[model samples]
Target: MRILLAAALLLTSAPVLAQQSPAKTMTASQDAFLRDYAETRRFMSGRPVNPRITPDEKTVLFLRGQPRAPIQTLFAFDVATGEAKEVLTPEAILKGSEETLTSEEKARRERMRVSARGFTSYQLSEDGERILVPLSGKLYLVERVSGKSTELKTGPGVIDPRFSADGQQVAYVRDNDVFRLEVASNKEHRVTTGGTPAKTHGLAEFVAQEEMSRFSGWWWSPDAKFIAYTESDTGQVEKLSIIDVMHPEKGAEDYSYPRPGKNNAKVRLGITPVTGGKTVWVQWDAEKYPYLATVMWPKKGPLTVLVQNRTQTEEKLLAVDTASGKTKELLTEKDDAWLELEQTFPVWLEDGSGFLWYTERNGGPEVELRNADGSLARSLVKPEAGFRNLARYIEKDRTLYFVGGPNPTESYLWRVKDGGAPEQVRPGTTGEAVEGGSVARSGNLAVISHSSPTSMPRTYVVRGDGSRVGELPSVAVEPGFVPVVEYREVGPLKFHSSLVRPRNAKPGQKLPTIVEVYAGPTVTVVHKSMAAHLLSQWMADQGFLIARFDGRGTPMRGAKWQRAVHLDFSGVTLEDQAAAVQALAAVVPEVDLQRVGIEGWSFGGYMGALAALKRPDVFKAAVAGAPVVDWLDYDTHYTERYLGLPQQHPEAYEKSSLLTYARDTSKPISPLLLIHGTADDNVYFFHTLKLSDALFRAGKYHELLPLSGLTHMVPDPLVTQRQHEWVMNHFKRHLAK
Candidate 1:
């Protein structure tokens, strides 16, 4: 069933290549120029490119694509020999069925189809003998010499497979339980058992995966002798059920989610031996440190676990001796609001006596080298003013790469040594270069660079001294497609929007402007990048002016921009968006303010609902999915960060809630379509339910799309397609007249 869903998402949309220039094609001289450009661009852009250097610094691996096919295959380039060889090919992995399959089988096949455009997680073995690839819930081991691949296991719902250092074992998760597979014997053994329903083992819930940015469940130790994982018990969490009314076979699903100020999932850490035995639970003093953010295994003998308290402001890094189970506090960090958890994996030093740490304590984020005993070795990458967040750290050479925004709307990449003022690397005035990844081992460098308003991704290789070596070919863009019409406007007539305009736009045609918003404190909507969403483009192609802007409360800049919406989240974001729209309407006469529409999911959904009610003069139509109407109904960790506790700030919470303004929406205002999944745990399905009831009692009319068997993150492709189609139809009926 999961495979079918995955296939549906993959096969649902076909790539529509825009027309390219004839000169865009690479010439012999142009190819050489591109090579140099890719190299120079890598250093200048501060992005990870090709020729990925290994920890040992001797070997380098890169991805090479055939110009004829749409797919890209992985290739290893030996810098020493100046030669490149193809390592993995789709032909080698894809086999069995050659004939055109049935519609159902085609759907399944599409789900299984791996795209070169999509990111694939591949890790080389410690010995560099084989590579582990997780494909379609199955682990595949590919030999370097013969390119021979063998499926290790085909378990029910398996992901995040990691190879042991000795390359003798492979560990993965199945049905929320961690398991280890013996390579030679092909035997699977469960390391952790007893997974309760709605609860998870070695993995995070949906909200944590998306909002908190957690993916992998289990972590391999330095010596590969033990594994540490997290367990979440959601039995006490609030349960929301959804019934899929649109499906031919109606089914119901119940999701346990912790909404704001509600019960949360209890989390704990445990360790298991690779050879298979009883797991040991790591005990923690709840009063001192209750939440487990991350656990690091600096050395095999003693495991260092970093735990954050329930308040999230205080963090303690505890060194637990695996032999005696004795724990000692190594370091502690605190903040007024909350300390940002190190979402990425921590890099341990060679000797394991100390490790690298990053903190946003002194106004902005900075890197600090700390000993295992918890004392700070030195402060690295300190800024005199403004906020700087460490993006990546190349520990081998003691260099740190970071993203800094002097202001909230703009961002740039900067680099510095272990302790120094960061030198600006990728300096830009308008759009931001979204740095993907950086691989700097043994002085050879590579970076992936892409900016807003461009679809092509360029790769570059740099030297140890930050000089360009060479550049890879540009990502092929379809030919003949030209963007001419301006879709949306912002600020004033001088400030033209960066939204992609439709090529077939007619003159004097006033298109309906659809605003996509996720007005939240933790995130921002505006980012300068060429990475386009297909759905956003589809709306534009259907003759809608799509525009998105980050309201107050979004991060990335300084405290003022983010804190502006504090204690007034919903109202502040809505007002900013409303003002931006009014300004845009005054400048861009092509946009019909009377036909303006807004749509969003989650926090954005909440904003859309509020905008339609609060600023009926601007937004004529709204589509909200899984919205939070009341702040009191949401979870503690997120809501408390902004509005404080409901008990402490009752007036603030009441004013910010959409439910308070629902009664004042008697006037014939914008038409609204509220969609929600019954099993939504994050925002809770009750938010929509209560809003629907409130509107009905107030004699207000609105459309409701209640789905069953769906969670906060809608999984069904059919439902997603229907949702978008309904939104487009609504805009076409009202805006495109």
Candidate 2:
């Protein structure tokens, strides 16, 4: 009777045990790493560390411990005296009866809970006595010493407020027009008011900001005499319509957005006096060159503006005399593909002899000391063991900091004297060194260390002599957080990856796996930072082994790693990711090869589609969001740089495109889900539409999720949540036994 009852129980529970048998338990070391990893995540989210040195160089401000709820208040560590103070308390910002606030006020307060979220533009005064904060689309002056704050202006779309050199007056932009405000008298005057519906007087359009990374459109002269601004006429550019559903009436909003080989906004440099009135347009012969790269005011001289030709192969650093309106070419850089310009203005030496310039003329990216007249003083730092790109320059201390890489996955911090041999500052460290802004006064170097994976960022202070002073107070790991089990332990996964196993995993159990990928060149997933990556963490918690790997073409490694994608955008990167996945599967027996899933957004979406098409056997399911299925469909500047001219490398472009493999996608592929915004300008909705048509013709069954009236980035939180939910659902449906 007992044997018969046991047989009945085994028969009843066989399916449930089989389902639970695949989850593999982590090892002791892995378990410890998981605990530490969890602690690292908690510590990072709770206590953020950033190196902040005073302008006098007498003190370094470091934050310790996490603030409660709103995250506005925390302990600030003063490096000099080793004293900590609580500053910027949440209680100061919160209204009376925080729970009883209006919905709008509550939303605003909640927005402040996330650091660096609410403000569109923020700047500290020269003396750090006051903070110029952009709130509710206007500028406000908040005293650091006293908790008092005053509204600076209430105008039409204000941004980029800058205090004059004397800190007496503030210059900012209002609806593309430049405005100057007196701090004490509260007097405001319109400096340049010619910005009409078609023409912008002192500010650039959306495309310039999104593509060129030019956020602020103006700069103030060191003498506080003139304001240099860019007036972009976007009427000539292509108009893209975006729908606004939040309005009482859902309607289309039209804006000019330039795509590749399309007409771009004609931008011109203009200088205006602080006293107010008209702006003098910086004269440039239209036949010679038209595009402006950057504008800067160096020392008390004329405004220096960097201009590039339409082809983007040649760049000229032209100094425009504000008084005379005469322009002279200070320096010209030419390249085979496209000349790279420094995003920030050139650092001027105190002596005014010249400035530090970064160029890639000698095979690889290097730094050269250019005289005030733009003659090369010397090549400060050149590539030695590997390709080096000057990321930042500390002019006061005569130190040049850069990221050099033997390969794309690994990067190291390197420094060299203004005219000395390059040396690895941090040796044998596998992580990338993120340069904090140069301390203007002390000439001390501040950096944040990051690794490919399994390493969190830690701030450090280094002297100009290549000696480490000490690590600044960093995020403390929480006691209960576990790393190994909660995070992926994939070795040297190309470009770094973090894996997470289920909490209930047992020894030798095989588990289905999912990979979250973003193959964009601009962003790196494996950086050594404490970011709340919700998708991967959520998937791991849901009993699926999840992984994230940054393929080649990701940033922070240096020139070669980024430039390698040139002319072969998706091919080489996809190959590296596939190899990494296979390597991970081989090492981790619990990764069930038959039930693997891959997903990404934008460029990542492009990669996901390619992965499923190229290696159907490896990736069982794929969720691609707003993917650029074809290189021809993407914008010109970005696509042409990486994939070269479509006319030049037709075969390479075709091979890299997922559309080319549509006919060959007859394998027993896992379920594929394609999502896109209907009005996506960056990666057009047409990309998904064309792919869907092709897939249908190929007799493939795939899910298509279209977000109506959405742009390139779906800003609606509900839509974003739904997208994540769809991805999770796809993974659960395919990867689950």
Candidate 3:
């Protein structure tokens, strides 16, 4: 649950600066600092994203770009030829005109946090003959031979264009309607025409895209005979206006935003023919199971739809009949806390007899292969490490490739054969044929990008037996500095922590400390990857000892650890951070407890501000960026999932807000700096204003830095640098005793 505000320069991997056209606003000193502190060049280089191995396993396709040259270029890595060729560039796609995108397109891109231009994503045809790419609200077909693109003359606002199973037809959304085009004849047909200003087809609703991780409203059936798509009516959702005060001429953006306990988008599933015909409505108890989580259509089996209730505590996996639009419940999972959603799941076996499901049914999360009738076949993974994510399900080999590590700080690859117990594929390092250590597999050939805390990440092409074929050429330039990190679990609560000390510090030298934390339920702060803590490394270079912890509320440990803070965000998260500090001080021996500071964004921001106001004895100074002062202001799915209905759980709502403790003059309100962007739609700027009002009423002096036209994820590098400098100075003023 990273709020969009952290989008700018996320890690060393996703660098924000463009090398082809670097921003000239950076000062020479700032440039030098960027080089010496953490080296932004490593981010720009070696960023090979969306690596998909070709079906023939002879080559791999990936998107690459750099700072100054942020517009991505599609490239192919020859498995045997050992040649890397540029497929197409954003310049080639745009030709000469500047990009003109629709509001709908822009919203979807923002939801994905798409940073680069050209081919950010693409879909290979089932036959592996061609690729389909949607760019600038239009569709393009890329030829495998010459890499030349042929723009499909589809109507405007074409998005999520995907090829049908056999690659004869393509389906996409235009305006709000779903449309399909024949590749050979360029014949286009409208699948649905009932989309109105309040109702839409083919495009995912707000909550589905933002929270549920289901980006599209449409799913194509196996035979390409019928298409299943969601129709959403946003008429009931409340509209919130987000205006660009930086440039008043641009006016305000009226967005349909659903806050907690409010009406979410009304969605229904329907099926239509590829040649365009009457729609068959899929019947379900919509009121009971309203949240559509995901849609998976097996190559030869029934369509699977995952749905959840408004509270998100229970989820249902249903198998739908394409012809009659009838669905039967395949499985149901219930949790006291909200059920976790995976980006990839409901893996159907190649033969279509059973499907693999990720669950916590027996003590912890694991992969369970179940029959079509919902009977368990076998458990694919041991719960000790806990199931993380599915990497590649090699149907031909009947092997399930996935990732999970014993500890949250590290993740490793694993595989299981025919519903058997899983085993580590390539252990002894971080990074896998998965994300963080991204892996791409095709025909038993996999290209993996991996790294560790002390090592620079690299790319490797390996075979099914885990033997390396060769190394993929990486354009990455290694950073000048190697981080000195100590990964540990602190406190009786067993909080996962990463500590970085100043390079020249002596063993017993006491130093002012900054506890950087994002101790939220949604994401972890400490990870095994080197890219995870580059910011902390840079802060450590500034002469302050930096420590971070993933305490009770964070995920990946187990449901119990995560559910500990179910309705009590304030008590569990902040207490764990404080406890970690105390425990670390006892173990490390040089922690300057008297001059400790806290800094974080979003949920962590709330923690920092709350600490300064209520627990100032421990946190001497704080930096709160885009803090959520009141839980009531957040969107429905995310807020209610943890806090429950605010009306029913009034005490929980009251107990969690920073405003509840704003007037607590317990410790003279330690130095606090509140930073935010006025145009942030996710957390909203009003949160900070509400906190400021409360603090001002309490006669607490604080600093506020308002960015005019930025969103939660500050995409602009200059603003990011300024914000970083602001936090450093604030810490220096109060914590450097």
Task: For each candidate in turn, give its C-alpha RMSD to the true structure in angstroms.
Answer: 8.9, 8.8, 5.5
How far is 287's C-alpha from truth in model 2 (Å)?
5.2
lDDT of each: 0.62, 0.62, 0.78
Our tally of clashes for model 1 stands at 35
State TM-scores per candidate: 0.76, 0.77, 0.93
What lDDT tens digits, residue by residue, belong to model 1 across residues 245-310?
Answer: 445375655656566556667877777786667667777685566566666665422577677665
Highest TM-score model number? 3
Tens-place lDDT per residue, model 2, 1-737, is 00010011111101322222111333454344333443333335334454455555544544344421213233334555555565543334433423122222222222232222233234566776766655445567767567476777546455567888777889876655788888998788878877764687666555445555555678888878778787778788777665533342656646565665566678778777877756778887654566676776766445777776665677788778787678998888876656555566466666677877777676555667888899989987764434335445666667776666544445566667766876666555544333323333544544444533334455555665446655555435533333342333354544566677765678678787887888677676653333334335545666688877766677545556656676676676787777777778777788787878888888889888887777777888998888898887676556665666566668768887888886565554457888877756567677998887887777767777777656565444445544555566667667777
Any runs in candidate 3 off by more than 4 Å, and if so which? 1-31, 35-46, 395-397, 419-421, 430-443, 665-667
Q: Please, what are the lDDT tens digits per residue for candidate 3 over residues 1-737?
A: 11223323211212333322122333464445555333343354447777888777787888877533456678888888767888877788888977667878777877776756666788998767798887778888988977668988799888888999899899999878999999998878888888875899989987778777789989888788889999999999999988776566777788888988888889999988877889998877789999888889888567888888888889899988777888899889998777877757788877788888888756567877788788888777766665677777766666777777667777666777866766666655443222333344433676666767866666677776577777656665556566788888888878888899977788898888999988987788786667666667767766689999898878888778888888888997888888899999989988999989999998889989988887888999999999999998888888899989887788888899988888665547877888888887788898998988888777777767777777777655556665676678778768776
As a whole number from 0 to 100, the lDDT of residue 712 in candidate 3 is 74
**What is model 1's C-alpha RMSD?**
8.9
Error of model 2, residue 371, in angstroms: 2.3
